[model samples]
Target chain A: MSRVRICRVGESQFAAALLPREAAMPEGLSTRSGRRDAARFAVYRNNVGVGLTRALERRYPVTLRLVGEDFFRAMAREYVALAPPTSPVMLAYGSQFPEFVENFPPAAGIAYLADVARLEDAMASAFHAADEACLAMDALMAIPPDQLGDVRLTAHPAARLVSSPHPVGTIYARHGQDAVSPVTHWCAETVLVTRPHIRCEMQVLPVEEAGFAAALFSDEALGPAAEQAASRGGFDFGRALLRLVSAGAFSAAVNSAEKEARHA
Target chain B: MSIAFSKRGPRLGFFEVHAENYMGEGGLPHHQLRSIAERYPLSLHGVGLSIGGEGDLDRDHLKRLRRLVERYRPASFSEHLAWSTHESAFFNDLLPLPYTPETLERVARHVAEAQDILGVRMLLENPSTYLVFEESTIDEIDFLAAVSNRTGCGLLLDVNNVVVSSINHRLDPFAYVDRFPLDKVGEIHLAGYDEVTDEAGERLLIDAHASEILPDVFDLYRHTLRRFGPLPTLIEWDNDVPEFPLLFAEAERVTAALQEAWRLQPEAAARRSAA
Candidate 1:
């Protein structure tokens, strides 16, 4: 038989056997002595499992700390087996881990773990998102006051808003420490993640401003977004706009007249 | 290390990075890489191309690699001879393949395609294997030589991998080096291996790359340098990486070995002067 045909036949089996923790050794593999060595095959198995688990650990350090290392490792291994990375870019791996944690039975009790994972994922995304120039605060000031309402602001590529029912921002900030401070306020929180410069910055948005920020992110004009924020009662449109602009949430500000002129 | 390289850490030979790590659209990775490239030479080493897979190459991945190559124009570009992906699932580890004429044809075609797309010659690295396939008809070194000869691609002579695989397969490391195509070697890699016992009560070496190079691996590296002359050498410590100072110390050892190798071979010096 042609060795090529045999290789084509055995490679899929070889790949299938390496994934599952309880998989049997694929046939036709042997040591130099020609023995079907399970221990020898286990090296590849260990490499795949350990390599992916370490990748998850690096991505979700906060989640690892939330649950101690042992539990986290076990959870990571299970996740790896279930959803081994589809992409070779290890940095892009584990994008679906937050959802996996949410549906996981053992982790269901910790309602905040999934949100924490989500925050970390957003932070990572922002860190690696396209490098676009942030809209200077002066650009917004340069607009005529009357034309401001018709201005549509473009969200920065690196800007991400993560809203959770749990106090996830506080949990994420308390990471990398031995003791996590108790969250005195147990309510919903919205976080804005942006990399205006080299550092990734996160801020908790006031509950009233979440709607406004969401509207702005979705490309709503200033007038409507501010109106949406005002409908929430006691919403300060000027203060919210200034805060987001200063945070480098938007990349560009174009007035309706300029947009129409460009179209013409 | 990216930070250290950017901040002008101990100046050494060229710096290499995994191509996949910098495949993101834009970010700190690109920024840091740009800074490093401006200062020193960069090598684009890919770990996820899956060049030896039985299936067709990933076009999207090849495109991304092309974009990276176009942007950086690195001093060298290379990938492993082993495969890492099968179908849609990427194993994230360099999986082994059987060496046969059919597999050889597929790999050479893949390498030629990659070179066509990348618009640059690539060096293919030998892998450290624990088990051998029953269907493999070609020796590992011969398979590498055939691929290089067929595709016109260079080889990356990893001395530590020679030590690891030779011991695992019960072959002599020096003999394996003697048989390697030194003329095609564009680069060298030295790393540490983890030793374990196999089921048949034999010693198995795992290319863990988590610590310093072993004494025996260093000896083989010296032997390789004596035969092949000095080349651009890299010390890989991907996992359990120590501080920059310690990694630089390892690079210093490679430097010392390279200088000694250059002194020992007068023809190699003459060849360099003639070039």
Candidate 2:
């Protein structure tokens, strides 16, 4: 057979056998003694299973802590079997895992597990996101007070906002602890993850500012975003904008007038 | 790794990192690598290219690798002889392939294409396999030699893989080293392996880089150095990674062996320098 046909035939069987736990020994493989040793083939299977599971474990430490090691490993094995990585870059391998956890039956009882997974995924993404200079506080202050509302801000390349109906920020913050304090107040939370500098910083946005922050992230001009945020009472637009700017959320600020002039 | 290389750890010859891990556009990985690149030579080792896959290479992946090379301009680039992806699913492990003429041609084409796209001569490392293929018509050394000759690529003679594969196949490690095209070797890798038993109760070695380099592997490494002269060697301890001090100690052992090899084979050193 041609090499393509040979590899197609052999690798198809080999790939088929790797993911499934009870797959029979792939054909045409042998030990030095010419026997089709299941144990020998099992090594490859174990490498694939263990290697991928470890990758997930590295990415989702909080999830592992929540479920404990054994449970997490079993769950990760299922995730690996179902959604094997489609890309070679492992940094983005388990992007679909949070959704998978949401639909997983065993983890259904933990209502906040999926959200926590989402939070962790967002943190990983923010950590790996492209680096860019954040808009300096002085730069924001340099805008004339009259035209401040016309300024549009761009979200930093490394900024990620994850809003969840559960207090995922508290749960995520308790990572690496042996014993986590009970979260007495079950409430909605929004986490803004950003690699402002070398360290990845996660801050839980207050409920009132979540809408304003989301609007800004979606590239809304400050005037309109704050107006919509103001309709909902207690949304301090000044405080929220200052907080996000200090946290290095936005990268650049462009006035709507200047933007229009450039377009013209 | 950046911490070890940068902070109070022992200074070594060079540092290697998996290319896939740094595929991100920009982040701590790039930051750390840039700092390390400024201080020492960098070896960009890839584990995800699947150069030995039956299918055509992933162009997007090749593009990403090219971008990394252009950004870093690493001293050397190497990948395993095993395949890691099939169809679109990446297994993340270096899976074995049968050595056949047809496979040889496909691998050569892929290597050439990679070299053409990467704009650099690459090194192909030998794999430690647990199973053999019934369709394998060419010996492993000859297969690597042919690929090197066809593509003008260098070989990364991993001594740990030599011991693991030789013992797994019940072949002689010394003989395998003798057969290898030493002139084409640009770098060397020494890692530890885990031992297990096969179905027939025979010993099987898995190339698990979780522990210290074994005495047997070290012996094979010294033998290789004696034959091929001292080359740039890396101590790969990915899993159960110890403190920087311990990993550096492993490097120290390699250094000692390398010095001994240099002392023993002055003529080999001269030949290498002349070449």
What DockQ does candidate 2 score? Answer: 0.66
Calculate DockQ per candidate and list them. 0.69, 0.66
Worst 10 residues of 2 chain A by lDDT: A1-10
TM-score of chain B of each: 0.95, 0.96
Candidate 2 residue spans exceeding 4 A from truth: A1-9, A261-264, B1-9
Please identify model 1 stretches exceeding 4 Å from their true place: A1-9, A261-264, B1-9, B272-275
TM-score, chain B, predicted structure 1: 0.95
lDDT (C-alpha, whole model) for all candidates: 0.90, 0.91
TM-score of each: 0.95, 0.96
In model 1, what is the error at residue B272, expressed in angstroms?
Answer: 5.2
Q: Report the lDDT tens digits of candidate 1 across residue range A77-148.
A: 999989998889888899899999999999989999999999999988888889899999888999989878
